[model samples]
Target chain A: MLTINDLARPGLEPVNLEISAGEIVAIMGPSGAGKSLLLRAISDLDPNTGMVMLGGRAREAMPAPTWRKEVGYLPAEPGWWAETVGEHFQNWPSQQDSLATLGMPGDCGDWPISRLSTGERQRLGLVRLLEGVPQVLLLDEPTSGLDADTVESTERLIRDYIGTQRCCLWVTHDDAQAGRMATRCLRIEAGRLAEPTS
Target chain B: MSYITLDYADLAIAASLVLISGGASLVLRLDIERRLLIATLRMVVQLVLVGLVLKALFANVSPLWTGLAVVVMLAVAGREILARQSRPLAGFWAYGLGVSTMAVASTLVTVFALTTQVAPDPWYHPQYALPLFGMVLGNTMTGISLGLDTLVTSLTRERAAVEAKLTLGATIHEAMRPNARQALRTGLMPTVNAMAATGVVALPGMMTGQILSGVEPVEAVKYQILVMFLIAGGTGLGAILAVLAATWRLSDPRHRLRLDRLAASRD
Candidate 1:
C-alpha cells in the first residue's frame, strides 16, 4: 500500500491519494501538467513538501537507498551506465527470466547497450526495476516507446509482477491503455489532481 | 654561476616576441589582436607588481606577508574557477568550494614540502613558501575547476540518466559514480599527461627557469621532479574534493537531483 499526504509543489496543487496492494492507478494529464514531476516527487527524486508512506513505513523513516529499493521508480528513459546490458542489472541470473518475458534472449545481457532500440530499453527498464521486487512501482509512461504487441507483453509482465501486495502509480497518455491497465483513474488539470470527468 | 638580470632595455628587446605574435594574429585575421594586447599588458603589470611585492617580502622574510600573498593568490584562483563554471553552485557555495579546495590542497602540499623536503632555516621563508605554494595552488586550481565544471555540465546534460539510477535504488554516490569518475579523470588528465611528457617532449617551466638561472641541469631536474610530484598530489586531492563537494551541493538530503541548487549561468 502507498499513501501520499498533501503532496504539493510549484505548478502542482496539493492533493491526497492512496492505493491498496495490487491496485494500479493510472494518471492522465496534458503536457506540462506536472505529471512526470509528480512521479519524481513521489519517488523523492525532487524537492517537494509531503508525507509518503510505503507499507506503513514513512518515507522519512527509512534511508533513501532503502526507500528507493522498496519503492522502485522506472523513469520514462532508463539510464544505462555500463557498456553491456548485463552490467546494468544487479542480479543477472535471477532477472534472466524477466528478460525472456520481454522477448529478449536468455543471453541478452551480453548485448551492447548501444544496440538496444528505444522500445527495448523501455522494456528492459521495467525488467530492471522489477528485479528489485519493489513493494510500490512509480512508473512514468512505461509503455510509451513500445510497439502494439510489445506493449501488451509489457503490460502482461507488469500485471503479473503486481499480482498481490504491490501498488503501482502509472502515468499514461493513452486512454485505451489507461483503461486496460488501471483499476482507478485520475486526471491532472491545471496543476490539481481530480477524478476523471467522464 | 650567477645569471645576469635583464635591464629595462633587455626586457624591451625581449618584449618583441609579443609584438611578433600579435602581428601574426592580426595578419592571420584571428581577431584576437585586442585580446593578445590586453593579455600582454595584464601579464606585464601583474607580474611586475608581484615581483616588487615578492622582493619586499623576501627582504623582510615575514610569515604575515607570505600568508597574505598565498591568500590573495587563492582568492584570484577561486574567482577564476567561478568564472569558468557553466552552471556554478548557487550563492556563496560556488566560490566557497573553490577557495576551500585550493586552501586545503595548496596548504597541505606546501607544508609537506617545507617541513620535509625544502627544510629552510625558517619554515615560513617567503621565497620558498610563496613560489612553491603558488605553483601547487595554481595547478590544483585548474584541476578543481576542470573537474567541477565537467561534473555540473555532465549532470545537467545527463539528468535523465542520473535520475534513472537514483530511482533504481542507487545512493547519490552510486548514481553519480560515472560522472564522478569522468570528472576526476578530466581534471587529472592534464597533469598526468604533463608528467608523462615531462623530459622527452617538453622541458617544464620551473626546470627551464632554474637551468637558465645557472643551476646545474641535474639539480634543476631534481627540484622539478619534487615539484611535479607535489603538484600531482595537490591537483588530485583538490579535484576529487571539488567534485565531491559540488555533487553534494547539487543534491538534496532525500537523494534527489536538485538542479535548483545551481545558479543558471549566463553563457
Candidate 2:
C-alpha cells in the first residue's frame, strides 16, 4: 500500500491519497495542471513537503536510492543515457522476456538509442521500469506515443504485472483509458485534486 | 657569455610595434584601439610593479614575505576561476571550492619539488620557492577552472539523464561519474598536449628567457623539463580535486540533482 499525507509544493495544492495493494489509480487533468509535479513529489525527485509511506515504511526511513528502487517512476518521455539500449539495463538476460512481451525483438537490446522510434522507446522504457519490480509505479502518460494495437497490448501487460502485491498511480489524458484501467479515477485542476463531475 | 641589458629605448621600440597594430585598427575603425592601448598600459605598469617587488623580495629572503606573495596569488587565481564560470555555484562555494583545491594541489607539488629537487641554501628561498609556486599555481588555476566549468555545465545539460539514473537507484557518484571523467579530461588536455609538443613545435617561454639571460642550453632544458613535470602534476591534481568537489556539491545526500545550487546564467 502507498499512502500520501498532505503532500504540498509551490504551485501544487496539498494532496492526500492512498492506493491499496493491487489497485490502479488514474490521475487526469487539463494541460498545465500539476499531475506530473504530483508524481515527482511522491517519488521524492523534487523538493516538497509531504509524508509518503510504502508498505508501512516511511519514504524517509531508508536512503533515497532504496526508496526510489521500491517506488519506480516511468517518465512520459523516458531518458536514455548510454549508447546502446542494453547498457542501461542491469540484467539483460532476465529482461528478455519482458522485452518480448512489449513486442521488442531479442536484438533490440543491441540497437542504438538514437535509432529507437518513439513507440519503441515507450515500450522499452516500460520494460526497463519493470526490471526493478517496484512496489509502487508512477507512470506519466505511459501510452501517449503508442498506436492503438500497441496500446492495448501494453495496457494488458501492465495489468498482468500489477499482481496482488503492487499498486500504480497512472497519469493519462484519455478518459477512456482511465475508465478501462483505473480502479478509481481523480482529476487535478491547477494543482488541486477533485472528483470528476462527469 | 654575457647578455646586453635592455634599456628604456629598447622598450620604446617594442612599444612602437604595438603602436603599429593599434594604428592599423584605428585606420580600419576596428574599434579595438582603445582596449588595446589600455591593455598595453596595464601590462607595462603591472610588470614594472612586480619587478620592483621581486627585487625587494629577493633581497629580504624571508619566509613570511614569500608566504604573503603566495597567498595573494592564490586569492587572485581563485577569483579568476569564479569569474570565468558561466554559471558558478551560488554563494561562498563559488570561490571556496576552486581556491582551496588550487592552493592545496599547487602548494603540495611546489613544496615537494623545492625540498627534494631544487634545494637552495634555504628551502624557503623566494628565488626558488616563489617562481616555482607561481608557475604551478598559474597552470593549476587554469586547469581547475576549466574542470569546474565543464563539470557544472555538462551536469546541467545532462540533467534529465542524470535524474533518470538517480530514479533508477543509481547513487549520485554513479550518476555523475561520466561527466566528472569528461571534465577531468578537458582540464588535463592542454597540459598533456603542451608536454607532447614541447621542444619540437614550440620553445617554452621560461626556457627561452633563461637562454637569453645566458643559461646553458642543456641546463635550461633540464629546468624546463622539471618545470613541465611539476606543472603537469599540479594541474592533474587540481583538476581532479575540483571536479570531485563540484560533483559532490551539485547533488544532495539523497542523491537528488540540486541544480538550484547553481547560480542562474546571465545570458
Candidate 3:
C-alpha cells in the first residue's frame, strides 16, 4: 500500500490518504488547483513535509534515488535529456513490451527526441516510467496529448501494469477518463483535496 | 643591450592613439566616446598606481607586504567574479566559493613555481611572487566566473530535464554530469586556446613584456611557457573546484534541485 499522512508544502494544504494495492485513484481539479503539487509531494520531487510509506517502508528511511525508483512521478510534459530516445532508457530492448503495448513503433527508440511529436513523447515517457516497475505511480495528465485511440491503448497498458501489486494516483481533467480508470475519484480546489460527495 | 625607458612625454604619444578611436566614435554617433575615455582613464590610473606600489614593494621585499597584495588581488577577483555572473548564488556563496577556490588554486600553483623553479633569495620575493600570483589569480578568476555563469544559467534553463532525471532515480551527480561537463569545457577553453595560439597567432603579453625589458628571447620564451603551464593548471583547478562546489550548493542532500538558492537575475 502507498500511504500519505499529513503531507504538506507551500501552496498545498495538508493531505492524508492511503492507496492500497491494485487501486487506481483519479484526481480531478481545475488548472492551478494543486493537483500536480499533491502528486509531486507524494513522489518527494518538490520539497514537502509528509510521511509517505510504500509497503510500510518510510520514504525518508531510504536514499532519495531508491525512494524515487519505487515511487515514480511522470510530469504532464515529460522531459527528455538525451539526443535519442534509446539513450534515456537503461535497456531499450527490455522495454519492448511496454513500448509495443503503447503502440510505439519498433524503430521509435532510434528517433531523436526533438523529432518526436507531443503524443509520441508522452507514450515514450510512460514506457520509460514502467521500465522500472515502480510500486506507486504518480502520473500527471499522462494522456493529455494523445489521440483517442492512443489514449485507450495507453489506459489499457496502465491497467494491465497495475493488475494486482501496484497502485496509481492519476491526475486528469477528463471526467470520462476518471470514470473509466478510477476505482475512487477525488477533487481538489485551490490547495485542498475533497473526498467524493457521492 | 639596455631597454629604453619611456618618460611621461613618450607615454603621451601612446595616449594620443585613444583619441583616434574616440574621435571615430564621435563621428559615427556611436555614443561610446565617453565610456571609452572613462575606461581609458581608469586603466591608466589603475596601472600607474599598481606600478608605484610595485616599486615600493620591490624595494622593501617583505613577506607581510606580499601577503597584503595577495589578499587585495583575491578580494578584487572575488568581486569581479560575482559581478560577472548574470545569476550568482544568493548570499555568502556568491562570493565565498569563487574567492576561496581561486585563492587556494593560485596560491598553491604560484608558491610551488616560486619555490621549485624560480627560487629567488626569498621564495616570497614580491617581484616574483606577486607577478606570478597576479597572473594565476586573474586567469583563474576568469575561468571560475565563466564556469559559474554557464553552470547557473544552464541549470536554470535545463531544470526540467535535470528534475526528470532525478525523478527517474538518477543521483544528483549523475543528473548534473552533462551540464557540469559543458561548464568545465567553457571554463577551460580560453586557456587551451591561448596555449594553442601562443607562438603562431599571438605573442603572449608576458613574453612581449619580458622581451621589451631586454630578457633574451629564448629565456623569455621559457618563462612564458612556465607561466602558461602554471596558469592552465591554476585555471583548471579553480574552475573544477568552483563548478563542483556550486553544483553541490544548487542541490540538496535529498538529491533535489534547490534552484531557490540562486539569486534573482539583476536584469
Query: Model 2 reaches what TM-score against the true structure?
Result: 0.94
DockQ of each candidate, alpha-carbon based: 0.75, 0.74, 0.80
> Tens-digit lDDT track for model 2 on A1-198?
999999999879999998999999999999789999999898888788989999889999999999999999988878889999999898987887777777789887789999989889888888888888888899999999988988898999999999778999999999999999999999999999988898
Q: What is the TM-score of each candidate against the true structure?
A: 0.93, 0.94, 0.96
lDDT of 3 at B70: 94
Error of 1 at A150 (Å): 2.2
For model 3, the docking class works out as medium
Clashes of 3: 0
For residues A1-198, could you state the per-residue lDDT of candidate 3 as single tens digits?
998899999989999999999999999989998999998888787789979999999999999999999999999988889899999898898888778788888877789999999888888988888888798899999999999998999999999889999999999999999999999999989999989687
lDDT of 1 by residue, A1-198 (tens): 899999988888887998999899999999889888788788888778889898788999998888888988888888877789888887888886777777878888899989998888998888888878898888989889888888898899899888887889999999999989999999998888999878
Task: State the weakest 10-residue window (summed lDDT) of model 2 chain B.
Answer: B251-260
Superposed model 1: Cα runs more than 4 Å off = A93-96, B16-38, B265-267
Worst-scoring 10-residue span by lDDT in model 1 chain B? B258-267
Task: Identify the runs in model 3 with alpha carbons over 4 angstroms from their true place.
Answer: B26-30
> What lDDT tens digits, residue by residue, belong to model 1 across residues B1-267?
689788899989999999999999999998998998999999999899989998999999888888888888889999999988987888999899988987998899999999999999699999899889989998999999999999988888888788878887888888888888999999999899999999899889999999999999999999999999999999999998888888888887888888888887676
